[model samples]
Target chain A: MTGRHDPYVRLLRWYPKAWRDANGAVWVDTLREQSEAEGWSRPSRGEAVAAVVNGLGTRLDARAAAQLALGGIAVRAAVEVTMQIASPGGISVQDPALNGLVWIFLSAFAIPVFGGLVALSRSYGVLSPRRALAVLAAGAVGICLFAAAMWASAYGFQLADDNPALARVASAAIPLGAAALAIGATAGWLVVDGMLSRTRLRRLPRAALSLVAGVVLAGLAGYATMMTLGWVTVGVTVVGLSMRSLGGWSSVEPRVVVRSRLSLVRTLAGISAAISMLGIGYAVTAPAWSPLAENPTTAVVHAILVLLVGALPLVVALGLLAPRPRLHVWGPVALVLVAMAATFYGYTDAPLSTRIDSSVPIGSLALGLSLAWWVTARLATSRGDRLMAGIAITLACVVWHLAALLPVAVFVLPLVAGVLAVRGTLARREPIQAVRTAPVTDR
Target chain B: MATPLTPSAFWILTVLASGRRHGYDILSQTRTASDGRVSLKVATLYAALDRLETDGAIRADGDEIVDGRARRYYVLTDAGASRLEYEATAMAHAAKAAQRHLATRPALLTLAPVIR
Candidate 1:
């Protein structure tokens, strides 16, 4: 009994803490009794794998759903922020280069959005909507205060400006930055709460907290010198990183068998994939809408860079949905940290020609198409139908000139999808009497 | 009526049909009942049990201490028993209907030879 219990006890670590506390010993005892009765001393490879996979999957589903919801909100805020950055102020012909700097700054928002999703997903298994909404409201207030601080800072700086040109650029950035941050903060915080869910939190290792504090402090100090800090995203980055280190963790059984949980995982994956595609589309069409690109060559290069930057965080984030290779689980957090550092350093200093014309909101079409696909696929009658619809919608977005309809698309697609997901789930589960009662056929 | 029970849920209830049984006892009895065709992993078992308990198909009967470890037992409720009975009847009816339909195929085969 002792020998058999030893192996099962090790395998029990593959389960979530709550689950283990409730049923761990009982399971271990069962394993022991089975093994002893079967004349075996250890669990089989299949048993171990099943346990690990299921345990990991339960955790991933919760994490991925939160990430997906946050990703959607972040993209929406980015659309708003980028629009502010691109808009021309008064009659003055703004420097496209300055616009690029701000875009880069706010673009770092993607890191928090991505990092929050992945980190929270890895550490937690469920999202409590009330908690999320509460957190979002609090974060929004914080962002508003932060925005006010920036506004005051910019106004004071304006008072002592030696160079009118530099002051003009600074002034433009201040409000645009504030608005973007305020918006992103409100939205991004919700994303965090949704992703973190109610997974139990272990005490933060002092070492880990100290490391994060040190990095954030260093980022702040560097910002004072280079003025490169994307203050908004840095705040988001800190919050995102903190959320990741904040949870209790769990383990395996086939990795993914719970349908209710898996549905969220599937929906999030589909949505993330769609968003990544939209990011790609946004890059490809840079030549059409951007004002700074004087030539085709620059536009093409900028487009590529845009896609790479946008997709990098998302790629890392979505990878965390599957619980394996440990690298995928933690790699996104590191990547996000790197992104935060880069944003703080203000790396978007390319010449005007290299920057995107984000003022036009050209990417909204892609966002709409993705949202359409996200919603439609979930409600589609079957998986095959969903797959075909996704392909069709994606192709249409790429080929058709539907960029103008984006505002409407963003609102409608998600709304329709939400309705369909709910309706479809309910409709599908109708009693057998409502279904065909004919004799079972071989086919 | 409620939707038909899933395979795991149905089996769990079937195991409980005999009497109240703890987690391990249910697992062991289920394996024996299925003649080794089914093996319920711990996570899967608990997920099913949890759902069953939620749906009012099963209830926690009691717990006992064995060798200093606690064993929580579960029993099929009236709802569960009736659900099982209905599912069994439905399956049996379907089987008879299919058997009758299949009986005609062999008869058709015999008629082919007679017609020749």
Candidate 2:
């Protein structure tokens, strides 16, 4: 009995005892068969090592899912705190400057959401083609009108400054921009119709195509707007585009056909909520700059930036988790509280000592990293090689996120974890192997 | 040869089966076939095509240059023709049953009790 439990038994230790007791024999038999077919004299050391690693990996996957739930809660807490601090007087965009910024953010967000919704509605048979076209037409017109409004506002500012030349130039350009918008809208309608009629584009799933198009268009519009506003330099645009393209390449692969159109709707909603939060962040934070520009401290800037970027991740995560079976009820509530707390700390003129005590940055960072890890790990393990690549890329994203605080950890942890994940996936290592024998009948 | 078809799918497949067409052509064809009862949009046409392709009813035949852009073409497959036949046969049987059931009814009631 002891001999039977030698090398194989030690490998079995890597598996959960309950899982081992249940499926150990079958697993060991499978491994033995695989080893024999591969012409190993016996279960080679490499095969044994792989079996042990893979066994442990399955256990880790189970733990990761549970950890994600907990990590989500922690992140939600931090987000709620942040939101609370940010919404001091409640969200309002009465001020013109703030309102302008809000519109920019809305335009940035709405284009994608509306585009996706139109695509989804058409695909699901909820909307007729004419109606979808109408929606697209209406959306394009609305965008043009918004652009015109922005130009008008700029003109008004110029008029007030007695700068007729600038106003005149803007007036001339407005119509051209509006025309371009109209043309773009019409082209969109035509392209969609043509694709559908011809049946070439229709070969792909509607939601997947819409998602791809929406993301691409939204990114383009965002970049264009940023460029127009001088927020991003040409170099930044080039770099951003390259990064996004690389990300796209990394993620491109076959995915399980998610037949539920509602899931696509949920994803769209998540994107919308993220954009709305970003808009609200701009609305609240932009004005602070004007008022506090003279004596802007590093602490204040840091707090503001944290609150702004942090709002997006928080809202999107909560939005996603809100419909989930287990976390639906408590998730949003906890998230709101954490966002509120963070907002309060951000807005108050409290000393750094008090604010630091109030803010849970470390906890937030840990939660964020863990959630990212869980998401990446799940993708890495289940999706095979493509997802293993994704794990590397996502780790890069994790590092990027972490670089704001602990730059060293960002570089080190992701590299280490990424390498391990890649090795584990590539090597197909299992941490335990079960010994197979004749079935025993219970009395 | 093939059985009768549903009004919508019948019209759609007939339009595509004729030859390759872009959005405007399909919409025009559907409208003409339906006698102005249906006016398809770009979105609806594509959506239907997607479903049809997934069901193995039709496939993209080829593309042609139109206005400096490539316009895709679709051709109906054997599977699609078979499905159309099945739907048509089912409808015809249903219609025949309704006709028989209505034959014993009064003349005024005949018009009133339309088959669903």
Candidate 3:
């Protein structure tokens, strides 16, 4: 009988029931052989116990694998939905013809953001700055190369029509923009690396370099933006002034992390760089009689708009997070309020135009202010002081949610808060008390 | 002439020098070799493996398939062997010198007995 207490039944318990049922004879034979080989007078309890444990473990592992396989389908579906939501505009342009031309271009811009986020999140305890830097550098290089390839494919092989003006402008602007990015990146690298080398100045230099780089880059960005405006009216005046203010604020902060500043700039740089790259890609891929050649203005404006909008939250976030000599959360708070008001105004007046006019600027301002307050509070105070920072960040995310797609807000806000919380927690736990009361052994 | 290896790396390399092994095998071997003085976590083992691979001190020999599952195997490279040798020599020399000094000091000898 296959009962529990019988010797054969008890021996059967040494294996998973399923396994025992299937290969019980083989295992029983092996155990019998092992017992004889050892010259044992009797089968040991320990051997039986070992066999039982091994069999149970195998059964559990198989069960777990089966469960995981079932679960994976749901997980993959969720991840795909999340990715689609995370994609800008909540749309997938999957037309094979369009995708063939566009996916490479879009991926080039998107990969850096993905890489940066991954690098930032993955670097919790053991990762060093050097390693983080390497990841970022690799991401940047990959984007640049992708952009170049796309540009070549779009333009290098094509013979331009009689219009030399278009070619001349491209020839001048593309090389100039590339040079500026290269020089700016090199300068940023030098400033950051130099500051990092010193022990005492390690933290301070990061913020300082980022701010300076942001200002210099902003000027180059402004010149590019100015070229596109057909009529420099009141709207242009407001945008121009706001741009200067944003650039000024970006460059002035001295106590923020360099990476934070770099991230802010890189987001903008990615858009601008992508715009330039997109032009090259379009030129390479499109036919000689393409409509994109009519006016590169819209393309340039779109790129600038995206870069400026995306960079705003990042800048504000860093500004908030840096250690301020005084209580200056109000500055960023005011900026957020203004942006919110603008978004409201834009929503009531004209919805389509609002996407560019109000939403972009407001989103930028909210992101910048929120990030600034969070970073500043984190660097300046203990865990106890984080409640205000957390509240401010939560508010900014809420504002961002209102202005932009919910998924963007969802992904960014929690990440910002999570990073701040982790930093605060670790700061509190610093100088971890010695576990042992005995004198530390000198090796 | 060689860079000094940390005690953790030296111990790990020594264990692998015997033969290719999996994570659990290396962990148990290290504990036995160090007489239960050294203990490593699965996380630490993987991290060390990453660094060792990057440094070209060790290579993944292959994987052993058992019951449709695979266990990764690692082996020490020639460079790893030389590094272990260098570290062992340095440690042995330092240990010998310290023992000699301790043995010769009469005051230390007297104190040692009292402490014991």
Candidate 4:
């Protein structure tokens, strides 16, 4: 009889092609023999599902796991570098010669990370379009609130002599406002992260099951604990699996080889994370420190930025970098719903600094118009042209920063991209193999 | 590092250690060997078998057809035999250690007169 009558034979489609090629015929024969003797018409649902689940498990070979790790690392490093660019002289390193060239390269804008954000949201938008855009909108609001707080502090300090008590109250409130911003933002990300964790738990790969669990759990837990558990566990588990690569696998399993390669990847990610934390801590704290420690405004902003720097990877690793689930997609749904709930970002990044809000109304309008144009351009352009256009627009954006619209460039660019994505007018997802990842400006 | 085999793997290897067996035979015998407690689905059984063969612990000894069904007979490789022996030895040691610990239990429960 043709194997068509047997459901198990047909179910071989679930196993990967390579596996089916080698073991298909015998495997089918085994199933048939067993089923016939038992007088069963077909394998039960559980049996068929086990086959499929294990079949998918076989696909998570060493290389795919490595790619997963690369994606994780890319997200971590990108945010760090982005933050550093925004808050330069937080370290006050007098590279007088390099300074002009650094400014001239005019490419310190932290756009790619947001590009990654848009990519994640767009490509893996298992959530409905309206819902996802709404979440982006919420993130935008938190950013705007932060910008407003900064503006209030800077302008409040400028007119302090005229209104001393009001200025002190405003300056004192900056840190609290920024903290509230981080907390609100983090809470929003946590809700999304929780859902992503649930999705990951359901479709976990056998090879990386425990490690994936570690990543998800670490994301929900505290940052210091998460760093140890998240980073170290990734390293330990990679080596641990190799050491015990089932049957203490001898030659063929190649866990030993994988262990070495993964360690190399782990080590690289470790160094990158360390540098980012240091730069962020030093640089972000610098802006808040201001040698004018008496400045309550500076003190509060410093505390929050430093905290965010140290704590950001946790937020990002889960919210931005965690793999999208192929099945249920409540993460997008929930994030955008949260976005809708917090939909108060009706303003742009105009109030982020004195340069725009206090001194240069025309510049502020120009900045707003320019960001709008960039978002519109992303929607209109073709793929390759979009990237080229992104680079050009990002350059122009950096020039705008150099031209005195500096402070808003930090998270505002990503915010605009988030807005673009939520509108569903953003460009289609690119093959952002940009495993390369950063720029935060801490000015 | 001589890791212990999983229960299904152990039973599968044990069945093959006795003699060469086909897929269904291995599946059925593993059930018997595991006292029907470790029943394996067909896919799970084959996945384990394939993994064992890949690990050089087992190999297809021969193949033939019976009643129009292919029978791929697999035998335990030297590696498989050694690993199985290692696992059995470790299990024996663990059992002995547990029994010893049980033997050393405090008589605090003696205060309770054998309450069921």
Candidate 5:
């Protein structure tokens, strides 16, 4: 029932819109020409699948150097995880099922996921090398020590069961190694995020980028600090690094007016500040929070923490995937955040100290109020200033749990970071704005 | 320097060596010149064309819309022609040596089995 050109049109759709614009008609004509020559009105199903596979592979493989880089990391992850298990003190896995699961996680997921992310970053290149430099340092250190830890464990297992020397070294190394990989993998993602963000805001004026930074910084200084350590960490890291990037980091980024609605971006910044205040009936709010609440914010903070880590990302991911302005490659970003959430879940099982929880809020409140004033005074418009002043006064009061109520403030981390990672990868590899199309279709 | 070209790029250059050709013509002529040994897919040919153009081995000549089917023409560059010539020479030498080696081999080591 499909038209004569339908199959070819579908095949072309496997590629990018810009690609379709340039070569779609001609390419489809060739497919039709070939099919006609073969006495078939349409391409066989095999060709269609091959075309789809080819398109996805193009996004994944990116380039030969990137392919090698990713391939090496995947192989390295196998070595790292193997060493952890083989080493006596690396991990104490007595349960048979858990032990099997550990091995499976090491072998199956580590290489493909981490290496795949690294490969994804290659297509985007290094948008702002600042954060990448930091993540890379962590990853590189992790790699070296991980290799040492792995070697100690593997050799320790072979020589004797009671090798204290190797056990001591590996026990010290394994967790550090995994955390390093998490950091390293995250670095690739941060670069992907930077490139994606750069692409998304390409059409907006430079002032808008700084304003967006100001608003995110406000959230970091205000609401996000209490509930999200990782969220705050990645946020501060990105803001610090991306400021340079937004200023003109990528030489390759095209200087074209974007198809993006610029007003949409300003709305997004406004939304960030409004969501951070959890001042409503402050019960000390969180691990970091309002000192004025004294003890009342505890239960509310716990609820916010649960909501932030648990339900928020899936909601944010769905929101981000909305049509009209979709991010092409977000799978890796989601994967990294999920890993972070898994780490947070691990920490939850261990009881957190009440002293650190209660004591940190008062100090954080002083910091938050002070920061709110500076941000509002220096950057925001009259409307944004009013919102901040309101949030600030609320932070000073037990009258409202202003910053801690909404989990949406926490969602901003995944929203911004996820959106960044999404677009640099295509549906998508390489930012759509970058000149990086042909290597995939390379015959 | 004479670097080895991919088979698809080689055949494409070979077809373009004759004259400028559009996408469909390049596909058909590549099949013909290779004596049905080589066939290029549409996506692949376009990717190859893009890479070759990027590498300065080929350039777009012009465009024509014939009978509602648009065709973009491409011509091989001097770099492409020279590279094609180098590949052809290398292949020719290898082929000549192979034929010489084949001609020297005996039909049967002991005898022709009295067939003659």
Candidate 6:
């Protein structure tokens, strides 16, 4: 016969060590007593399972978050430095090569700083505006240091054939990158602040959440096919997204007793942010030297195209999840669509006789629309809302794909539908403001 | 405002209301107090206890070892007492309303005749 404490100990292992150290003994004794009273030598199966589930739901420790964030940043920085040092023909060229290294070094500043921010956010859910602003300031400072390092290398190291043009571009790109990061972080903080301040919905419609999930998943799948990979990748991505969405939807509703899953979600979010940052880094460094040096216009266009292909999906996902701008959220989206069209026109016409990939712009637009649909699903607190969003995304993807056979003008229908769907959601009578929950008492 | 306590949490609190009680004592008291209406699994009991302790509704009093196993005792706090009082008052009012409605109802509306 198993000792009464053995099964309890095994179950308790799921909890954080800090928690276990404080209450483990009491819990173990309680289990033994209860089992004896019930005439059992071992813990019941139901209780054991509940304990494991409860443990998984606990928020991540601040120390663990800090370590993950710092570790992820270090890895990113190492990858960037290695890639720079190992570039073709080495650093002997001095002019372009050193400039490239400077830019790479400057960009590396984002990794650790971002990791620290993620760790802090994990410790404190939904950072206050002041703290968010502070984080932005810290990020800016890191960027400045990156620039300063670059400037120091530019001035201090004597390299043969110093290139003024590459140096200027590097100088400009660092500030731009920093500004983008600041704007994005600030926007995200404000959204989180708003969401945290408002009443969170206790019960969401399962069908609705699932439907929205389907659209998001399908959009991600379509995006993979259109932008980066083949049908095989698309199938895999769709299946994964669907499974994840189903898992989230079917899980027990968020309970008043404990927001057990918050920590796990936060950890995953931090990891996703790090991965997205790597994608951004690759996008920034993707431009080939020959084309970039030959025609600046082509270089800019290519860089933008690459970003559209590589970085836009993640950006769209983040943007959808974040707070919307007061400009009806459609104004900027409309402008982007117009710009995409103009880019497509240029790709086909090519005033400078440069070959542009037709798929890049179209794929980005399709993927972006799908991501937007997915984001709208977040708003589905009721039964049918997710279903509506999911439907819109699916239709939009279909329309976008139809452009291959039909006129590209058909794509506008999906955009209009998306805008209308969002507008309808906004027009709804105000949702019952959910009461603020007290901080969870136990893990 | 404090939400109504879940049945398990309420039962745990009721057992702890009298005096400091170790986990086993409280578990046994709950089963007896409710006349076997409520039986909490050990995991559920501890989970609730942990929450109660954090909410300042209960405090750990002391610990002792019995048969080489440590047993920790808990006592209800002032806040917990007040909250429990509030819940009891609310329940009483609800029960009174139900009784009043029952007492006033015209039961023999369509009866053919009296039993006499």
Model 6 lDDT tens row, A1-443? 13534776777788778777887887877776777767888778877776665554332333433333334334433543364457633355456446545444534434333434433443343443234334444444544444454554454343323655445544554565444444444434443433343232233443344345434433332232223123222222332233233233332223222223233323333443444344344434545444442455454444443333332232232233223332424443443444455355444534353423344335444544544444443442334434433433433333333223212332232332233233321124541122246443222
Judged by DockQ cut-offs, the docking class of candidate 2 is incorrect
CAPRI-style docking class of model 5 based on DockQ: incorrect
TM-score of chain B of 6: 0.87
The interface RMSD values of the models, given in order, are: 8.9, 23.6, 14.3, 9.8, 10.4, 7.1
DockQ of 1: 0.11
Give the winner by TM-score. Answer: 5
lDDT of 2 at A360: 42
Q: Score residue A205 of candidate 2 by CA lDDT.
A: 67
Q: Give the clashing pairs for model 6.
A: A57-A260, A208-A386
Per-residue lDDT tens digits of candidate 1, residues A171-288?
5646654554444444444444333322222235433443454344333422421232233233333333332343312222122223443355346434544544554455457568
Evaluated with DockQ, which candidate comes out highest?
4
Which is better, 2 or 5, measured by DockQ? Answer: 5
For each candidate, the alpha-carbon lDDT, in order, equals 0.48, 0.44, 0.45, 0.47, 0.48, 0.49
What is the Å distance of residue A430 in model 3 from its true position?
50
Tens digits of lDDT, candidate 5, A1-443: 12545878877767656566877677777777778888888886756765664444334323322333333333433443464457634454543334333333333323332333333343334322233334334444434444444454444443334555645644654674455445444444444445444332333543455445534433332232123132223322232222222232223322222234222323443343233223222323443554432344354544444434543334343333322212222333343344334333432422344332222333334334433433333332344323433242323321122223233345444344334343422133433333233221111
- Which is the better candidate, 1 or 5, if ranked by DockQ? 5
lDDT of 6 at A287: 55
Candidate 2 residues B1-98, lDDT tens each? 34233356677887876677654466568888879887543333544665576557888776565544335567779888777667657668989999
Most accurate candidate by lDDT: 6
DockQ of 6: 0.21
Model 2, position A166, has a per-residue lDDT of 54
Which residues of candidate 4, in runs, are more than 4 Å off? Answer: A62-443, B99-116
Chain B TM-score list for all models? 0.86, 0.72, 0.87, 0.90, 0.89, 0.87
Candidate 2's displacement at residue A326, Å, is 32
**What order do candidates take by lDDT, descending?**
6, 1, 5, 4, 3, 2
